[model samples]
Structure formats: structure tokens, C-alpha cells
Target: MKGLIVRIAAAVVLGAAIVTGSPGVGMAADATALIRAAFDNWRANSSESTVTMTIHRPGWERHLTMKGWTQGHDKALARFTAPAKDAGNATLKLGKTTLIFNPKLNQVIKLPASMLAQSWMGSDFSYNDLSKAEDILTEYSHKIIGTGHAGGHTVYSIEALPKPGAPVVWGKQQVKVRDDGVLLQETFFDQDMRVVRQMTTDKVGRIGGRDYPVVVTMRPAAKKGQWTRLDTTAARFNVPIPAYVFTRSNLQNPRN
Candidate 1:
């Protein structure tokens, strides 16, 4: 919720220790590391992915296919690749700035910071998800609130409270991470502590020779049948990506 693309990544952050530790024992008590591990796994140093997004309402559904790439925490890009009508539509985030390219209009629009909380392409994920996640992610104080076991691994329940005056909207965020640093779920709460929405890991599988949450769903707390699901069809993590990937020109005209 903290400026990240309402990503299933609540769906979590990055760190190398995520896949290294033993289950339930000799685990690092460092909550920051745990969160960083999960986040890192989700984005990694650099990654390229093909994704399928399903948006569901009470009586209708829509699907979109996209290609995505990330360059560390400051840069990311996603462009629709299917359904001819929506093809070439894209968003790019560099530092604190966000811009979207619309092939139909053939224009790139720079989004104001106030619009960061708005949805991205009318989906549950916000523009913030693709924007400056690291800046806002670093605004909270994380703690290991509880612990349990799952799939032969330790599951740490972490709670993140926004620091006073932090530029974040959630009152708190509840995170569940596995010993190996996989994020199982994240719940967002309003300032009054009311549940706002959540991102849950629907399935976990191997990607690029590492365990990953291949399927995840985001559903608002009060919406009955409205949700958005993202399926990471193919991905390669911590790989080298061309510099042009995060540029506005690339968003408008693909070169990678």
C-alpha cells in the first residue's frame, strides 16, 4: 500500500537470505531482512516476465496479457502485449515519476504524485505499484509479530506500522513470510484499522530455478466478487536488462 503498485507482491520485497535459511530454527530475527527478502524475490535485481491478468467482477471478466521488466527498485515498466486494441499501452516508473503511454492517443502522459494511489488500467493494482515502491516501502517500521510453520518452513507473521508523518495511506500492513522468504499474504488496513483490501498468494511454483508465487489475487475487503488475479506465466530473475527498458521512449516504442 505504501506507493507500490498494489502488487500481489504484498506479494513482498528483496533479499538474498530468503532461500537460504533453515525452517523454524536459526532463522534471522531481522524483520527488515525478511521483508526485503520477499520483496527482492518478487522484483529481484532485474527481471523480465510475461504475465496474464484477469479482472473479475460480479458478472463479467476481462483478461489482459502483458510483458514486464524491472531494473532494481527505481525503475519498472509494463506494456500490454495482447488483444490488439489494448496493445502498446504501457506504464513506466523512474524514480518518483510515473508516465503512461497510450498507443491510441500516441502520447505519453506524466502522472502527478496525487494520482499514484489511483488504479492502473482500471485494475485493483494502483499506479503506485509500478512507481516508487522503495521510497514508500522504507517508510514503515516492521516487526515479527508471530510465527508458525508452513510447507516445512517457518512462517513469520510480520506487522508493519507506518511511522508518524510517513507519506503512506495504510494504518498498518500485515505480512506473512516463509522462512525462505516467500511472501504468503499482505493485508492493508485503513487509519482506523479497518481492513481495506489484501493481496494473497494463490499458488507457489518454481520460476527461474527459484520458488515463486506464480499466481496471486488482489481483492478489496468489501467487494464481494471483484478482484484482479495476476499469473506470472514466464520469468527470468536477476538477469541483465538493456538500459532502454525503463525509458519513456521504450514505453512508447518498444526496442527491448
Candidate 2:
């Protein structure tokens, strides 16, 4: 659970930054401020929501459904209810230790010090990107390269390069931002500019009184039939999430 939450946070934070950060290329100085404002608005209230994930590939597919709650940015709970093998599994991703509940074993396992670069649920998103927010500005310096179009929308093309001695993933990244500073798509590259993976957002809407993209998708750039889509439904903001909602035991004994 800890690992999953970290990946979820990383994805959400970066996506939110991209969505709220774009303003005008001519007003580069204001981009940072605009992004901050957007973030604050989105985070104005804590949230709880259910996520239904669909994974598609050439010969295989999966449906992962979970209902969980969250408070602010650091805590989350998810209960898996699909793909029989993972059913009745509950995970609480809080801070560092990811507590996983296995009904088959009737015990909770703590996953710590695990490899951070592996895939989550056999999908494209890495384990590292699932938890903590990647400090792009802190770990890598970015410069506006140019403007481009992604998903048929005009976007600002920004190139990011890692700082010296920073152990970052990918050699570089290209971000496509809308005129208002929302990130429409992000492309990760190797040293030679060959795209490694890509993340995109669709179906933007106001959820829980904040602007949110209802659907997020990630996939390898050259993969023809591999992709993961996360669809969020009926999200509400600033709701009182019970303290026990994030506990490991609750996931194992959800009916309690």
C-alpha cells in the first residue's frame, strides 16, 4: 500500500503541476506562480474517491477496481476487488511502510526496501513513480524548448534535463502544456531522444469542486497494445474521512 500510494501521489502531483502550471509562453515568469495557484485550488480540500482501472494489451487484459479514501497528500487506502488472485487484498500506503493485507494468509505483510523501478500491476508505471512526488525543479532543470501539439491541442514544449549527480529516471522529458498551463501529455526519453514511455490525461472536469481529469492513461511509447487507464468516479472534496479508514486491519476486515 505504501508503494502504491507513493506512485499515485507522484502521478497526481506531477499531473496536477502540469495542469495548473501552464499560462502563456510569453509570460514564462508567471508560469510558476500560475501552477502554484492551481495546485492550491485543487488541494483546497481533502478528498476521497474510488478508482476503476482497466489494463489492455495484445493478448491479455485486466480490471482492477478499488474503493479507498485519502486525506491531503500523504495518506491513502485501497482495496482490490478484481482479478481473483488479488481479491480481498487491502493496502494502506502511509509514509514509508506499505502494509498489505492478504486474506488468503489472513496476515498483513509490510513491504519496505523493495525495488523502486519495477512495474506496478504489470503496467507501465514504475514503483518509484507511485509514491513520492518527483522533484522535477529540484532534481532537474527545465527550459522551454518550443511549442507543440499533443492530443490535437496546442502545448508548450518544455525540455527537462537532470542536474549533475542526480539519479533520475530517463535522460530527458518533454512536456506538452496547454495555453492555460495544464499539462496534456508528457514523454520520457532516453539519451538519444527515443521515447521510453508516455503519460496522458483526458476527460478533464470539476470533481469535488476542483478541476480534475477524470481519466489518466500511461503506456510505453512504442507498444501497440499496452496501456493502463484509470477512471475516477463520484469524487467529493473536504469530506470527513474516518481515522480508521487508512488502517491495515480495516482492509482485511472491511465489513467490521
Candidate 3:
């Protein structure tokens, strides 16, 4: 229940930004701006989306259907809508706080700072990915180190190093983006500089009249035959989202 599709929406919006941003070889992009462009594109004023998440384990797989809403960068709510057992479960993020709503328990629980790095619902995505996926823009120093041409587009590889004392989990993050602002992939490294996990785009296509990453997979380096795939089924960007949508009560109850 993170900004999964919203991020995908960013990729598509970037695909359309070729008119304003550079789109050829030898062009330079402001590292921070590049990061911001991808993040801000899809979540401009607000967004609503439907996504399917598939968790691939060594022996079995599980799928989930969820809906999400975002208003600006500070407020968001994602709730599971299908797979009967998981329905009505939700996660809400407001500024620095992240909370969970368990319909089974019928309680709203606030997540502690330490638990932000933990997995979300046994998935590969951490709570941080659900709540603070955009922190790289402000919490790290970024630089573009490589550039190449692919499929009539310029691709830039960026390195993001966490700023000192930042409450971030990764020691380093490498991001690859297309000139139009599409996020190609993101690789995470541990404090000892070892690869921990990575998220890669498997397919990019048009959805809801927008170019987007339709399939993205997250894999842990240490685990074999185990990964999570996120499919952005549908999306509507920059849509008017009601203010009440981000409230804790809405996360627990239903008002969307």
C-alpha cells in the first residue's frame, strides 16, 4: 500500500516530459531535479490507482488487489480491496507518521520509528518503501555517473548516497532513469557495500492514456526464487482527491 502505481505514473509522466527536459545524448540533468521529476510527475496534486501485487515465494505465490490515493507528497492511503482475507487492511502515511488499520482487529495502530524498516505484510517492500520512498530527494546526495542511449531515449544512471545521520536504511541507492524521467531500476546496497535488493522494470506500456511501467519486480539478492512483483493495473493522475481520504478514520472505516 505504498505509492507503487503513483511512482509508475511518474515514469509515464516523465515519458511525456521530453518536450521540456533534455532527451538526447550529451545532455546533463540536475541530479536532484531528475529525482524530483520522476517523483513529482505522477503525484502532482493527487492520484488514484489500482494495483495488483504478487508475492513469489519458493513454493507458492500470493496475489493482492489494492487501491491507493495520494494528495501531494505528505499524505497517502493504500487499502487492500480484494483477496477477501486481506480486505479492509490499510496503511496511511502523513508526513513522518505511518499507521496501519487492521479491520480484523478493528484497530488503528501507529508504527514506531524502528519498525519503518521492517517488511510490509510479509512482502519484500519495507514499511519505509511504503511511507518514505521519496526520501532520496532530500536525504541523499545524488550524482549522475553514466549515460547511454536506449530505444531512442537517453538513459542516465545516478548514485545516491545517504547524507550523514539521515534516518535512512540503505547505505547507497543506484537509480537509472530515462531522459523523459522514467525510472528504469533502483538497486540497494547494504552498509558494507553489498547488494541487498533491487527493483527492476519488466515492462513499460501505455495505461490510462499515459506511458507507464506496467510491471515491476523486487528481488532480494540473498534469496533465491523469492521476489515480489507489482503490476499497476489502472491509474488516474492529478485527479482531485478529497481531503478526508487521508484521515485515520477513513483508513479504518470507508468513505472513498
Best by TM-score: 1
**lDDT agreement with native, every candidate:** 0.70, 0.55, 0.68
Itemize residue pairs with steric clashes in candidate 3: 14-180
Candidate 3 global lDDT: 0.68
Off by over 4 Å in 2: 1-45, 83-85, 112-114, 148-154, 179-181, 191-193, 251-256
- For every model in order, what is the number of clashing pairs? 14, 13, 1
lDDT of 2 by residue, 1-256 (tens): 1111112322221122223223353255333333333333333234555666677999988877655555655565656667788777665656555666778999997765454455655656554444323345446676667765655555666667878888766688666555544445567788787988776776666666555655667778788889877666656657887777767668678852
lDDT of 1 by residue, 64-145 (tens): 8887777776677878878788889888877788788999999999999999666777777777665327542599998889
Comparing 1 with 3 on lDDT, the higher-scoring candidate is 1
Ranking by TM-score: 1, 3, 2
TM-score of each: 0.90, 0.73, 0.89
Best of the two (2, 3) by lDDT:
3
Write down the worst ten-residue block by lDDT for model 2.
Answer: 1-10
Please state the error at residue 74 of candidate 2 in Å. Answer: 2.8
Clashes of 3: 1
- Candidate 3 has a TM-score of 0.89
Off by over 4 Å in 1: 1-26
Candidate 3 wrong stretches, greater than 4 Å? 2-28
Lowest summed-lDDT stretch of 10 residues in model 1? Answer: 8-17
